[model samples]
Target: MNSSFSIGIPSGRNSSACGYCSPPGERSQGESSYQVAGFDAVQLTCQTYQGMIDRGWRRSGTWCYKPDLRASCCPQYTIRLDALQFKPSKSQRKVLNRWNRYVLEGEPDDAAASSQKSRSGKSSTEFVLPIAVHASEISNLSDESPTHRFEVTLEPSTFTEEKFTLYKKYQSTIHNDHKNSSAGFKRFLVESPLKDEPIPYPQTPPPYLPRQYGSYHQLYRIDGKLMAMAVLDILPTCVSSVYFMYDIDWEDHSLGKLSAMREVSLAREIHEAGVDNMLYLYMGFYIHSCPKMKYKGDYSPSFLADPETYEWFPLESCRPSLDTFRYACFSHPSHSSDEVITDEPDYLQVPLSSDDEKEIRMLVASGKRNFVVSLSESPYWQYDEIQRECLPCIHGLGIDLSKGVIFKI
Candidate 1:
């Protein structure tokens, strides 16, 4: 059963070096990121988590935060693609076809490698992704043996010795992090606060597919050895991609691009199986100014979430506004000074006011769990300073999503 509440302890605010523009060990004064508010979530149901993301919140392990886009060095716009409408580009198709060829046909000669569509020789634009992605896996029954035996399996996000070994190596080779530990790995990728909920598929899914929506580790293995892993959250309306790590040895196979295509295919397959709303693939945080991050916009028919309105706009249409301003408003045609949303209160750092350190013992106060408070109650706190702190969060979350979540003081 799904829980009625999403539980979390408010962790006021935080600031850090900007990942998009800043170099390692150099925290640029101008390139810093600030989050408005955050939480150490204990647990959340898929529906409530979905609502949280719609309000521009993202989670890393058990910690969730909403980016202060107006003030941040780089604005992160949440992006999604309609798997049904998605048309893979020539480069994307090449990436997938090459990987599949390497898997089923072994290392092809230079001449044979050029003809990637030799798997079936049908290059029709109208193709089913589930079929395309699964084609290479069936070569075992063929007369010719494959170069690599590949298997992609879905398992719960748990700490396994084998996974940790691959993760450690990936960190050392790809990220240059040799100091990573197993516990830290579990905290970042394995542990999740989202509760598993049965996906309402009319019929049970095949063993290879998910029957429930929750956090999962999609493991990619070749010849019985782990090659890659993708951390994913199968949500109510979308497949939320969290993180992907792979062995650098397989870099030539374009595993990063291959993983994304497989994920999009998974979304499509899930939608066709029974669920109507499961066809969208949520590729987290599209930062336009960052050249590496802009590749997500290359996917046709993608949408970027407006920071202010929480509305989705076509990625192409939003590019001009994004180019003109740090924070973009999708509702407008071009950017202007009025589009910037900022009026930050003069914040005093701790140890706060003199009264805070006084001997007067504070009394414990609390509210019921999963409570709903409306913006209409604004009048009650209108004349107080508390309104300043409270109203901004309400505005950030929007009225409906603010009420839908349980705020633990």
Candidate 2:
């Protein structure tokens, strides 16, 4: 399968709710809402998507976008974990063991129960068990305890009644997101632009495993009950976590942290199976200003992408910079610069061919000031061309491109 994709020019500018900087009733002292640039993607390749993620871009279904890092009140950092080096902490280990024991043995471990009470003053009884077994049955009964009864399977993004039902429950219970409809859930989670290309594993997988590549819904089951699901993009370089939702009733299990840890484990397994570059588990954006998002930093030995240079820096090294300013550009001496410049940086410049220059000149002469140039044909130079030639040429023509024009490369 050809892993090729196209992107629409960035559009849709709006104010952010400022959940991090401002509370519910207060107005933001700084710029209240940030501008967002979006692109409608068609059949985005794994490699291309990976590159975009590294460059601080994300997607909602086929719509790809990057927050204006320089201007946003809560500048998001692209955070990723080195799966191979991951070591579970005592707490993390407890979560894993708790889940495994419950699924395999149909009940929480005695030690885990004690630990839960000591830590949170809550009993393990608070943790809700699976309601009913479906076609994928996970029964409590067993003749002999199998060593590895619990299983995880990866399937392509698809809308299923079960998944939709679970999503509805998760939204209403966890986020209080009652307005989310099945259509919205499908658009946000099930639909993807990447082609299905399952990377074969070296070792034999479970009989029920649906090992397809590209984007997948990784279902974690014990006995056979679908306990949790993780939406991920399996790319050449890394596994990108798009979104994760689980049975909200199982809140006591700490499924969020467990899902992350599981993703890292998946990455490790993929690497060991021969995908050498598949060593990182991308945890999406980390906003320092958001107290709720601080847990993303707990995954130690992780790195955050510097917005300016697009270089990865240790999370610890970047924390000091983030502490002083809302937006931190680690590559620059000032660390925080809010000024907007029309000129493109040198690093983003691409050498323009004669045809390219003539086309640009024609567009400028004709007064076609607002438009996005599709650079799908020139994958290697797309990013550079957009920043270098496209922006500069438009700016020289007295057209401030930042107002709306987006060069979709």
Candidate 3:
């Protein structure tokens, strides 16, 4: 079972909506509480909570504290997947077979998911997960392979020096870019003041998973080796996957999918056995601009958490409006619940630099209000590659390259 929950992203709509900002917040009548029913039909919205945090709003686990809006409840749910109905692609099967041979038979695994027939036309010893790490999140599940019994256990990470070493190894394996310094990573782990000693990394774990709520961390190991680990923030009704990483060496094993699948299984098992309202997997956003990211929406039957009405609508039903401001409202559970799928000007057109003014004039003279650049003023331009790639997309989201401005047109 996996589902989504809404995190209210406030729209600068009615002024009284701002009244929810008062300290020790108050909730007005007629304002609906953002609640949903059953794990099967869960949906949620995104809130500008990060921005709100700066304005003195506090965080209680994953739920943000609104001084005045006491009526708001952190909505969450779990959705049942007909896992047996899933079908893995040809590439997926190759990955699975390779891992099966390697892990069970000690044979060489195929490095690639695509089957072009090995040079010898015989299976080799090298094996890897058939899927790419960047593949769609929805593709993680597969009913194509026969199900096998696996063990499940819950234990806190030992936080030993050895585990810490493994953690570093995992980080090094994935950080091909080497963007962070050893010091910077260390500083990030310890943001609060400690007395005589510092909080241990890979031992105590961080307070919250980057995007989830609640304070819990656990390590999952298979056989005798540590293969996968998750640092999640468990909320009242959902579990948000904060940071999930698996050994790249176990790529053929589909450990990333296994981690998520296991989590879902655990949630189902837990719910069946006793836990209350534990539905939905907040796997984070599914950005279509990032192809590797769109898979999150494939886990049917799903609906985007509308930002307006706090309701859930079928994803297939909203295909027509995905590119418009209407999509924002329709995709949001909040707006959907209230049946408020309307839009206002979300962006403003500003002038570009003098150097670019001539180009702007030419575009304007041709009655082309749609220029591809300088939507905003930034010292250095960003998203150039994104613009180039998106330009060819038939449903491409317009790229305002001039001022680095992008409005959902």
Best-fitting candidate, measured by lDDT? 1
Report the lDDT tens digits of candidate 2 across residue range 213-257: 688898876546666789998877788899998886678879898
For residue 88, model 2's alpha carbon misses the true position, in angstroms, by: 1.6
Candidate 1 is scored at a TM of 0.83
Q: For residue 94, what is the lDDT in candidate 2? A: 59
Leading candidate by TM-score: 1
* Ranking of models by lDDT: 1, 2, 3
- Badly placed stretches (over 4 Å) of model 1 are 22-29, 109-112, 116-126, 138-145, 333-395
Q: 186-208 in candidate 3: lDDT tens per residue?
A: 33321111111121123333222
RMSD of 2: 8.4
Please list the C-alpha lDDT of all candidates, in the order they appear: 0.72, 0.64, 0.35
